[model samples]
Target: MSQHAVLDNNTHRDLRVRIEPNADLGDAIMSCVTVPAEFRQVQAHFPILFHKNQANGAFNAIALFGFENGENLFLEGGKWDALYRPLALSIQPFLIGRSADGDGPGQVHIDMDHARTGDANGVRLFDEGGQATPYLEDIASRLGLLDAGYRASEAFFAALRQHELLEPLTLEIELDDGAKRSLVGFHIIDEERLRALDAATLGELHEAGYLMPIFMALASLSHITELVARKNRREAHG
Candidate 1:
């Protein structure tokens, strides 16, 4: 796809704002003069606040977007954070932006708490609290597992194994106490793949104890590909 088309495609799939790169930071600040109706709707639901300051004939604006009650994850929070964390840690001078003027530049900043306090330099895109949504927490709790750090797939697999789900070809996942229920598919790990994993890796999984099964299941299902890819990319560059 052409560059514009590719960007357009991504914009559709994700929540983003474009600002002119060349424009004075002040001009960029003013450019958000009108909040798009869709954004206003989002503002109504979540805390999307902007502060603009005038100095040296230039404007400095900081926009704070908050996710409340788990709704904003799709727009610009936890989901994006989960997807980008591994990649961000590897890349330096990493920033996301856009330009107000088409020919100018724009930027999107991913801010994370871990990035702050010198834990990491990049902007944090996800809230740690939101990372453990009740639905996911329930999944873990029922299976007697803990979060494998902030990685969702790892946490999921940990829950699975803790609950001894490996032998079951298929199982009923009760999402809630009500009538809601869904069937979860399962796959058996082949000996080749199992054997390929070294002792240290196996030990790490075992160390996770109840969490090990969940990570194994996630690995088998390929749910951790993005996280693993990001981790590999970071290692390559580091």
Candidate 2:
């Protein structure tokens, strides 16, 4: 397969497959930022609805995973303060979309003040007029974005598997703006000992810098994958 095609497939497969515990932060972000049943439950409580842009024609949806207190935060919101508070911890956002899906319809603003009671378990959604609607459950049930996010992730992993770069490699690229950016994915095929890389190569990336987050993600994924494999083996033998 062509390099582009291979990479695309590999990305998709990677999405479907959970990240190994050894995966670095990037992988962890990808794996954990998925839309699952638990996340759906959370979304059911706090639903933020918005429209997406049109250029791409595919499914449109995004799933955000963060921390608010002890509970996990997942919702759709434009304003950072509304969805994330200063005290919140480990806040990360994931966007899911496609060309076919087109931009979302009208936007709906939810009022957190009235929606949030003393309960910290989940979020509550409000209507346009800032009124509580009994149909919250019904609205949550029909959220298509959550499912769309899962599908998008699967597609990304599949693309990666096709590339045969699943092992581990560092990606270094030079942007059009004359800036260099280095990102370490789950695979790291080559290692630079700082001294080996020429001054020119190093200089390009000096401003953009290398992202260590991807390494952390890969480590986390590797660990999770091992745990899952062990559990499966035990079950089979038992």
Per-residue error for 78 in candidate 1, Å, reads 10
lDDT of every model, 2 decimals:
0.28, 0.29
For model 1, the superposed segments whose C-alpha errors exceed 4 Å read 1-169, 175-180, 185-238
Predicted candidate 2 versus true structure: per-residue lDDT over 1-238, tens digit per residue = 1111111222222221111111121222211232322233323222211112345522221222221122222211322223322111121111223334555542222221221212334333334455434444333333344444444444433432333223433435443345443433224212333335567745543333221221222233333333333334433554
Taking the tens digit of each residue's C-alpha lDDT, what string does model 1 give over 1-238? 1123211223322222222121211121211211211222223222222222224321111111111121212122112332211122222212333455534433333222211211333223233532433432332332221111222333434433444333323323222223332222223333354556668766765675533333332242332233233433433554
The reply for model 2, stretches above 4 Å from the true place, is 1-123, 127-196, 221-225, 233-238
* Index of the highest-TM-score prediction: 2
